[model samples]
Target: MREIAVVFVLLAFLAHSAMGEEMVFFADDLYKAAATPELHASLVDPAVAPGGSTALKIVVANSGRVLALLPTGIQGSSLEASREMQEELRSVDALNVVATLTAKDPVSVLSGPATIPLLPSGTAQPVEFLVQVGEGAEGPYHLDLRLDYEHQIDVRISAGQASPLYVPANVSEEITIHAGGSRESFRADYARSELWPGENGTLTLVIRNLAGPAGNCSARLLAAPPFRASDQPVSLGYMQPGDLALATFWVEVGDNASVRQYQMACQVLQDGESSAWSSTIPLTVAVEEGQSIQIWLVPLPLILALAFLAWRWWQG
Candidate 1:
């Protein structure tokens, strides 16, 4: 009888200890709620070009609270469900949460100060990360957001025995970004490749705004030695995305221009700055010697008169 009582006591203590330990599990709905249409991450601006800075907003709402303690084997007795139950609800400091952003393609983070600093319980915090897309970027990209945090639970065993337990919290979320605008909308190319020395010809250029927002824009040509721009600047008032514009300049080929190809520059001007918004492209100019001309036709009346005069002289 004595041995059986000792065995029961040992079992009860084992059961109690198991119930006293705290176990932290993330709510299954945590990530799902964030992925919802209303809470999903989004870009502040719909349009962004490579090397341009844009904002990526990440919203995280933690509904996860300490789970209730399980009942112990002893009748009319309960083990503290969890350490958190010993203390009332506490706010999770934003400083405890650490967030990192990554993508399949490399991106530069420009958001100042910090990312996802103070996240309170039962409330959503929208964190914005200013970032610049890398070169060679195209439409449709996925960014990986990793959040690491610590949940501190107050454990009180007795007077002067209060201690805090730290639970590591880690969560990963993937957000989609639709990157647009390839380089600039405007394109520059030479209309004609060949030029003749000492001749006035049209330097035809075709400019097109491909796949971008509409705005007021202007264009200009920059020429080097042996190539001169007849028109310094041309007005391209309002151009919509994918709009095409044409500009022609009458250029005189220098008499000293060599037969080799010379490069001319053309670009789209920015609204306020002297720099060009679009990339500068080389316009190839090839100078060739003028072709020789020969007269093949004479006046019919003069030829007939000369023939008659010759006949009269021969007859005399």
Candidate 2:
């Protein structure tokens, strides 16, 4: 009887030792590396501009150990041997996986904390984070992620003889982020505040390049109600950073235009690319009503009579 009891204890000890081994395998292709610490993450991209969102793929693996003992000669049964100690694995409860994001200097965290329900030895899970950058944020930025979870591991050595072990997992990863630099926008103003009807005038605009990498700039004027631009689209060539270029547009006021101010719109494009629209500005031009036609006609007949008399004298 003593020998049999010792034998049973030895078998239980061997089984416990075999079940304690666990290996975690992460997909290398899916891992994103950060610039600072040489660690692996789910995502680290520089293409994220101001007010953008990015997703991270967080996966947990148990190394294909989901089964119990199988025939030795059968292929792919070695991992199944661990299942002998975990027959109640399928009946175990689920776990809550929580993730949070934090951005370093120059980068602001808009919104984040994507959570999911994960199971042991299950498929990969994904989390997302939203961030925004400041206009003056000319920086090399990065993000830090914190992952926390509560998992309940099940171990069953025999029928109706199972024990539950609760474990908490926490991990941290860093990701890189980026944003665009500031640039000076184009602005336009009228040369004169007011003009008479049927009068031709010029409008002046200043294109400022201030720290932006834009070239081949051009602008088009859009007018409405009694205002017409002689040059619809004016071309203003390249301007280097900290340099300003002057643009002028010839415009005319309609003869019958009202004496009120009319609003005009201007659209700018860069690099001679029609598909891209740089900026839109508003301009105001005022037209004053002209004198009555009768006032001007009073001298027209006198001038004609003088001309006729001159022609009669020549004939004489």
Candidate 3:
């Protein structure tokens, strides 16, 4: 009986060891490194501008036994012509802000100090960051991002602290890239405010009409870290003389929604008839759990009737 008990215990230990074996993970990254051309050359880049906000983004993948940690830091930067535009870029609310992790796959990601977390044992999750450039120094300036990471150790780790990266880190620094500076006029208009959750919240627009018809238009939503369209042409449709046709479409936010205001837009047709739109109407989502929120526009139908009555009395 004693010998049998010892044999059972040994088998249980072996089974647990087998289950704890580490699994290898892998992912491929197609990256573009930034470079500088001769100062005299003109390159067209719609990303960097003087007075507007252009986003800088990069993707990262990790495979390890524990969550990956990329430290807080800057990666790279490009120059922009036009001092006026530069001032606007630098002056925006989040301008000159330090780098922090903005997004991650498997979703529900947020910023953290020191290091950002990466997934383990799977090549499917990709991490992304949104760097907002508010008012920043003139072009020809070097921007830096500190890359740091942490991982869980087999031993105990203290609260609010982390172990060093378990996997090797390979982030490309300065590859090779150039930039351009050309002014393109832009305009965006809203239809009204108020939208339904998981429904299409639409907007209209008129851009570069006076600047010579319209060019490329786009739609953007600033929920938090800033999420804009990645593969969409949020542009306007066609129109007839004196007839303002549609310009942009709304994002279907699906069934899950919360109380929030959204901005929206559309654009005039010309030069690609491009369009720009806000993510939401200024209207609140007015959603509640286990209940429905209804929002309707209250129109004053009697205003026109009262105006006609007053006109008749004045004529008499």
Candidate 4:
């Protein structure tokens, strides 16, 4: 009978020990599963003008919070447990964050990636990036936003406790923005579209105001190799919407210019405004080969008159 009782007592002790171990393991698993981070991102200003540079503002926020209680079987006093709970709650904070902005085609990110040392829970941070919209870009465009960071996932407060565990995380988002507005427009017309090598001619540029009214508007020609311009900038004084103005430039073709079409650019600007507008008007002109017979024919009339006079004298 004594031996049976001792055996029964030993079995009960073993069962209690096993139950405590199981509870401790369950508590650790609960802590790891409850602490998680959630991040949200949005653009502050969503409208931008084409052919211009603007600052893109983005706001990043942390919405994660502690919603579960600490499980039982973890050994700690009431005060100690409160401290541990607070530390666990901070596990949702994002650390060492980096945000990169990207776009396709007509939109370009001019600034580098933004970095944040730490972002606390229930808080937000604003980041600004300089971006450029292409000259031909219009309508709506999408920009890619990526965020990389690390956050605490688990914390150990009992025996054999070490540092908190941090895991790497990433988030991807898209920002949409409208990129179009009223801007200056121009068109070019050449008075002499065709020219001969070593020839001088005139080029006429017709300017039409498609945007708002402007004062002291002027236009200039930008000539490249094989083409030379001797005219200065022409003033249009004041221009209203849908108004048309003409600018003429004296162009000289190089002697050894190739017999092909060449492209040139025209620049337009406003006099008293801090904002300067530019448009690429690809004005093309063809250079043709000069005929030797046509050159000789120019002096044929004078030569014929002199020969006729001399022949009459000789005949007399």
Candidate 5:
């Protein structure tokens, strides 16, 4: 009988401890329902670039409060497709007024020596910024968002952190175009490589003039095969000499597309005339896994000639 009583007492104490512990969860601030949409865009704009830079535009709206001690200067969550997608959101201080946006105290809201009072309910007045969409990012990315919050329950007897990520359905599509080249030089030679289906990588465009001659140039990427049939065409803008251009794109298998022997090419432009285009970079996009595609291959004739010459010299 005493053992039963002891067990009951232990369970009661544990239950009470758990109940009083605070659990932080995210809920859309009912008052600012309209702001939620804006917030979503702001949060994502900095990190989104798809189907060339021409398709990029910044979007912002304040959604409901994402409950938690939202960590600052961290990529909350994003889909990873573009070669490099970067986004930043911060409220260093309020614009109209001055105050520290990420102040230590929940009640403290000051932007640059300007103090902004809290909302009527003592809610943390948040100032968020979703600034500047990245340029020329291709393909789609669903950034991983920290959808949940952290809290302590059971009268602070225990604490835990939670990351809530919603399952993603294809929300947006992206297509990026870039020239193949050595990271050191966006020269014409390095840009010639066949891209296969299921192959994805960054295209770096380095536009340089004749060194002495001053001129304007444009770098363009045309979609072919698997990349061509995507929803719509992605256009790369005209790049000037010293134009630092980049785009990330992906290649998915198409109905008729082969993992072997696909075609894509690169074209360069100066003034208005196009440079002698690079060789057609041939590729073999695979499906069921037969062989790794190599966009760059040695010419058969060159290989045979070299082998013959080596044999003759060895005999001598």
Candidate 6:
């Protein structure tokens, strides 16, 4: 009985060792099954101008190689092994992919996150995002592209086995775009800066083209409350770089306008494109109170009339 008990203890120890070895082998197989999908992205058009709206085209692809090995120590038929291997290869495909783009100040992403239902291995898909650049933006800017998706890692083909492991992947990439430097296209100055309430006057704006040449350039007054432009847009004709021109508008001030400095703007249009205004130049003007009649002057007129009547009566 003692010998039998000792033999039983030895058998149990060997069984434990065998189980440990199997686990180690299974862990190694899982490591071998681990694969990462390769993705590359870039902007379709890398050059952009400040104060402009554009689209960013991102192309995503999966270039991961499929694994050709089965889990270790599994005694399955060739057909079963083939099926499992196929499933493992399919795991290289990215599923439920989501992409997000982020930008810093002066650059804004107008569109929301882009989505992809499936990205099969060795396949590429294109996604677009609308971007708006501020007027002050200049030089090269870096935009962040983030990709999130689920990818299958391993498949279990036994009863009560856990479902295929779908691992979440996060990829961060940087995209560079060159933005043209911003320059003052035009400078504006007012010819007359003061007007009285209930007054009609001609307002002149001296516009100097500081940047590029423009043709059919015109300027219109953006008169708000308390001011109105009676004339249409005034033409400045063709202007070369560094050229100066004048635009005049017949303006009427409201009677109830306040006696203070009022802010105004001038809209400059080029090439008869009324829908697209090149720039808005800010302006400032002051409204003064009208002069009142003096009390002495009013009495002098009445005294003169009375004096003339007395002289006529005495002469009669």
Model 6 scores worst on lDDT over the 10 consecutive residues at 22-31
- Stronger candidate by TM-score (2 vs 6): 6
What is the Cα-based lDDT of residue 40 in candidate 6? Answer: 51
Candidate 1 residue lDDT tens string, 57-138:
5555554332222222223212333332333133132236667777655566665433555554444565777778887565
TM-score of each: 0.37, 0.35, 0.28, 0.47, 0.23, 0.46
Worst 10 residues of 5 by lDDT: 29-38
lDDT of 2 by residue, 1-316 (tens): 2232233333333433564523221111111111000111233133333444434333322212222221111222333334432343332233576778887656767676777675444234445666767654433366777767654433323233434344666667655443442123644432333345578777677766545556777776544324556434677777666566676777776554433334444555576543123333444445334532120111446434644655565569
TM-score for candidate 2, residues paired by index? 0.35
**What tens-digit string does per-residue lDDT give for candidate 4 at 1-316?**
2232233233333433443311112234322224445676656545566788989877777765543333333345665566565566676689988999999879999999999889987667878999999996755588888999998755666553545667788988777665653334644433335455578877777778777787888876555435566536778678887788888777787554433344555556578432234443444445444522110111446444645655566569
- Of the candidates numbered 3 and 6, which has the greater lDDT value? 6
lDDT per residue (tens digit) for residues 190-302 in model 6: 45554556887667779888768899998766554456664367899999998999988887875544333444445566786542333333334455446331111114454
Number of backbone collisions per candidate, in order? 4, 4, 39, 0, 42, 0
lDDT per residue for candidate 5 within 1-316, as digits (tens), equals 2232233233333433443322222231101000011112111112222222211221211222212111111222223211111110111111122221121211121222222232211112323422122343232233222211211111110122222222111112232223222122234333323344355533333333322333444545444424442332223355444444343334444333333333444444446544433323334444556532112223557445655655566569
Q: Rate the local accuracy (lDDT) of all candidates.
A: 0.47, 0.45, 0.28, 0.60, 0.29, 0.60
Candidate 3: list runs displaced more than 4 Å.
Answer: 1-184, 204-208, 214-245, 263-284, 288-316
Residue pairs with clashing backbones, model 2: 67-80, 67-83, 68-80, 68-84
Better-scoring candidate (TM-score), 4 or 6: 4
Q: What is the lDDT of residue 306 in candidate 4?
A: 48
Worst 10 residues of 3 by lDDT: 34-43
Better of 3 and 5 by lDDT: 5
lDDT of 6: 0.60
Model 2, position 194: C-alpha lDDT score: 39
Where model 5 places Cα greater than 4 Å from the true spot, the runs are: 1-187, 191-214, 229-253, 272-279, 288-316
